[model samples]
Target: MDIDFIRGARLDDHLTIKTYISEFKKASLTFAQEIVDQEGVTIAKALVKVACIDNVKMKPRPFLRLS
Candidate 1:
């Protein structure tokens, strides 16, 4: 999994954050998040990508089956 922050936010300012799944699968998920200040100004954005591996030796892979 990897998380990247695209903007900087102050530590003392009140923040509102929201996250939503952009894509989802049995073995993986992708999401985006946004952070805003109290004034409703966007202060930061993040994209998170995650992959599932069954074992340590197994390479990362995507979802193969859906239920």
Candidate 2:
């Protein structure tokens, strides 16, 4: 999984966080998220990607087919 932040967020400020799943598959998922202040200003943004992997084989995990 990888995460990147575009800006800094402060703890003292009231913030609203929203997230969306941009892509989804059996083996991986991609998401986009943002943090905004009460004034509707964007405080931070992030992109996340999660992938399924097999630790023992050190390779990507295969997706199961549904009937």
Which candidate tops TM-score? Answer: 2
Report the error of model 2 at residue 8, Å. 5.0
Q: Give stretches of model 2 more than 4 Å off.
A: 1-9, 63-67
**Model 1, range 1-67, lDDT digits (tens) per residue?**
4455655677788888899998888778888888888888887777787788868679766567748
Question: What total of clashing residue pairs does each candidate reach?
Answer: 0, 0
- For candidate 1, the 10 contiguous residues with the lowest summed lDDT are 1-10
> Could you tell me how far off, in angstroms, the CA of residue 49 lies in candidate 1 after the best superposition?
0.4
- Report lDDT per candidate: 0.78, 0.79
User: TM per model?
Assistant: 0.67, 0.71
C-alpha RMSD of each candidate structure in angstroms: 3.6, 3.1
User: Residue 15 error for model 1, in Å?
Assistant: 0.5
